[model samples]
Target: MPEGASHQSDSHTQREAEEEILAGLAASLGVVLAKPERVALSGGVFVEVDAATSDMGVVVEAYARQGRLKGAQPKKIAQDVLKLALLKREPGWERTRTIIAFASHEARNSISGWLARAAAEFGVELFVVEVSEELRARILDAQRRQVMANADLLADDLVVQTDSGR
Candidate 1:
């Protein structure tokens, strides 16, 4: 009902979908994965991957959108690639298998350009897993709701500007 409430709800929904996709990927890969502790980076920096094996052998970053990415979504994929690449640079993770999993073909295709190529060159595998129709529908609905919420917020801002004679 309030501004940003829908976004918060949509974010929760997307996170749930991402967890499901990660589980499916772990099952398909025959490897157990969990959110690992903050991985060390240079200069005492740290980062976390969505999932990884106990040995840090298999690391993953998952995206759970149902359709083509919009706005800054592509940047998120790029950030994932960078995270995996940085992880690879860490000792003992040089040989780790890194992945970026998607929940839909359309979402994957949205980055099938230079970003995809960069990911491949960085050794970040991209995959599309088959999710339940219900889950897919839920994600789509969330997307629609988020869009409408954004539009409503914009309209509200315009009304405030008009009232203020701006």
Candidate 2:
């Protein structure tokens, strides 16, 4: 390939990688939001679903910041999304009955501790998922499957199941 072509290919590859990373992040968030479980992470954050009547459930949200970043911190993002989800009440969604997963990897211990206390005050359970190489690969694979399934559905109106039920 020519030098220009090679450069173009590299740029394309980098863009694709970034897209994939963002997609994986979104997918991880989606899975956590969908599950109904009491979970909390080191950072001040929590997720909980109503237990008594199963009709009214709310996910309390909180987060801590360590360094400079943009937009909502991890915990704040999770909380905001959960609140939106609760308000929207998307199809097949029950009452807000899950602790939103908080992103605390970037926050300092002190801030995290404060956030944790705040989450506790609100009776929210915080959840944090450690990201390792293997975990990342798994998340990517799941995202790919979802994309493929969506594509197939759009093309042929068929539901594709990637899992073997294992």
Candidate 3:
């Protein structure tokens, strides 16, 4: 009820709202980003997506860091995705498809060079989307639903824990 406490709560809410927007952008792009049907593990933390049914196998892998929407290694991840795509004999993907999307304008600009390098290396495509105000709101709503669902699951867990403790 204190003024200071309310202000802090508001700040926290705003931060959460921002995070939800970024997550939504990522999720939306993820839906559009094509993936190979059979995701297989190759040695050295590599994954292969088999697109044998299509013209070429479009392999994709994501390297994520905690609290980082996209890491400094977009070029590397792009290269790996392209390599897998090529290994699957999906050259058409290189011409028709792109990999990588960032939630922020700054992040997108910072990684543009890396993205270009990777694209050139493998002859693949690249695209980036900045989080818009409307998209952010939609993402926040979806995130709120997810958070509520999670809270419900957590409440169930707490009940089980309490019963077990007794």
What are the lDDT scores of the predictions, listed in order? Answer: 0.87, 0.40, 0.45
TM-score result, candidate 2: 0.28
List clash counts for every candidate, in order: 0, 18, 2
Top-down lDDT ranking: 1, 3, 2
- The top-ranked prediction according to TM-score is 1
Cα-based TM-score, every candidate: 0.89, 0.28, 0.36
lDDT winner: 1
RMSD for all candidates, in order, please. Answer: 2.6, 16.8, 11.5
Over 46-129, each residue of candidate 2 has an lDDT whose tens digit, in order, gives: 445322112334333322222232444445544544453443344443444434332234432323455556545444445443
Tell me the lDDT of model 2 at 146: 47
Sort by TM-score, top down from the best: 1, 3, 2
Task: Give per-residue lDDT, candidate 3, residue 66.
Answer: 17
